[model samples]
Target: MEEYAREPCPWRIVDDCGGAFTMGAIGGGVFQSVKGFRNAPVVSLKDSLLGFRHRLKGSANAVRLRAPQIGGSFAVWGGLFSTIDCGLVRIRGKEDPWNSITSGAMTGAVLAARSGPLAMVGSAMMGGILLALIEGFGILLTRYTTALEPRLALATYSSPDPLAPGHLQVHAR
Candidate 1:
């Protein structure tokens, strides 16, 4: 009960999303105002402020239009990645570049299909190659770090003694 009482409100995270609206307003307002002044160097401060207001309105509308695309992409990407990754690991007992690239391309194609049929193929190619490269980078990073400092390896990072409380233990070697 004490822990629950001390915990922060769950709505706090949702409230943070609202802050993006204000940030977008300010960003759009300032950007358009600056551009307007640049194009017409002799514009008055009042005119610039009015331009800012109009830009702010447009920016709010743009956000509304883009919300669906953004949300859809988030859902599709996460769902595809998790599903494909798990499937590959289950079958092969480990993930590899081939599986990563194939899964990435499939998901990318679906994502790009929203734009057009042609875009789907292109996006798949790009996504597959990019995912493979990313995986390669991860492998290299782990190997490099493990060689330079063995203690920083993945196995070393695991908690060695979960049964004991109040202290975290890791193997020395």
Candidate 2:
């Protein structure tokens, strides 16, 4: 879990390698041939669920990465307050955690200013929206995080060597 403050861009925390990983596709033929196991009902169910979970988790992670990078770059290009407002509106609509947090901070800053009654009301509405977004983001993040771990564990543990000729061998360290 190393953090580096580089240029603003979406980053993925992939396994420390620069190669490709294959995933099963439609039709049981590819999976059955690679794993050398006839597709049973239970196995098919498990594989399908695992694949769905992986796709969901990966998409969530990508969103988390891109949102911050885009927000940061926008903040740099636009004024910080404008970026904060844009972030808030996006989060309120999309329910992203980072955007919600930024929105909250911005609302607080705006409210602290001695402004008119309408401005205060607008700030309060923004704050309420930010809260809702935060809650939604929390629920989504938890669901996706939980789903990812088991799917990844299954994939890691169930590695079948396609080159080998016989039954599946669980590799031992």
Candidate 3:
């Protein structure tokens, strides 16, 4: 019985080490969360850009879905481009979405400290309003700038080849 108990002690040590490694990974995850909150501006900018791209893609899809069947291949490509352009316009107004959170927090803190109770409440309200406005502005700007404009163009097949008989080759631009 004593030998068996001692034999498992080494295995227990290995298990403890594994537990410690997992704990370390969890701690790292927490650290990253904190860091992400702190770096909200950078993250917000990235998000705005991504949103713009998403909206642009949605616009392009809308065009492809709505286009009439009368046009030839050039017309199809032109229609796709026109739809993408509209999406770009929509996205351009939404850049810098995070700008308000970072800037508004600082501005709000300063105003809150400087003002009286009534003033503080008023300032806080104003801060909320300002933050919302800025966020809206950033989103619109990003959509127009990144999504609408052809920053990088690719010429992949927009539709399935009539010659090919399979569903896998049916591409949408």
By lDDT, who's the top model here? 1
- lDDT for 93 in candidate 3 is 46
TM-score of each: 0.50, 0.30, 0.27
RMSD of each: 12.3, 19.5, 28.8
Candidate 1 structure quality by residue, lDDT tens digits, 1-173:
01112112233323333444445545555555455444443334678787766665555555555554445445456556556655675677754567778878887887788899899999999989899889899779877866766554424324457665634445565
Stretches of candidate 3 exceeding 4 Å from the true structure: 1-99, 102-106, 151-173
Better of 2 and 3 by TM-score: 2
lDDT of each: 0.61, 0.46, 0.46
In candidate 3, what are the lDDT values of residues 47-90, reduced to their tens digit? 87865555555544443433222123324333332333333434
Task: Name the candidate, 1 or 2, with the larger lDDT value.
Answer: 1
**In model 3, where is the ten-residue run with the lowest total lDDT?**
1-10
Runs with alpha carbons beyond 4 Å of true place in candidate 1:
1-46, 109-121, 150-173
Model 2 segments more than 4 A misplaced: 1-114, 156-160, 163-173
C-alpha lDDT (0 to 100) for residue 168 of candidate 3: 39
Q: What is candidate 1's TM-score against the reference?
A: 0.50
Clashing pairs in 1: none
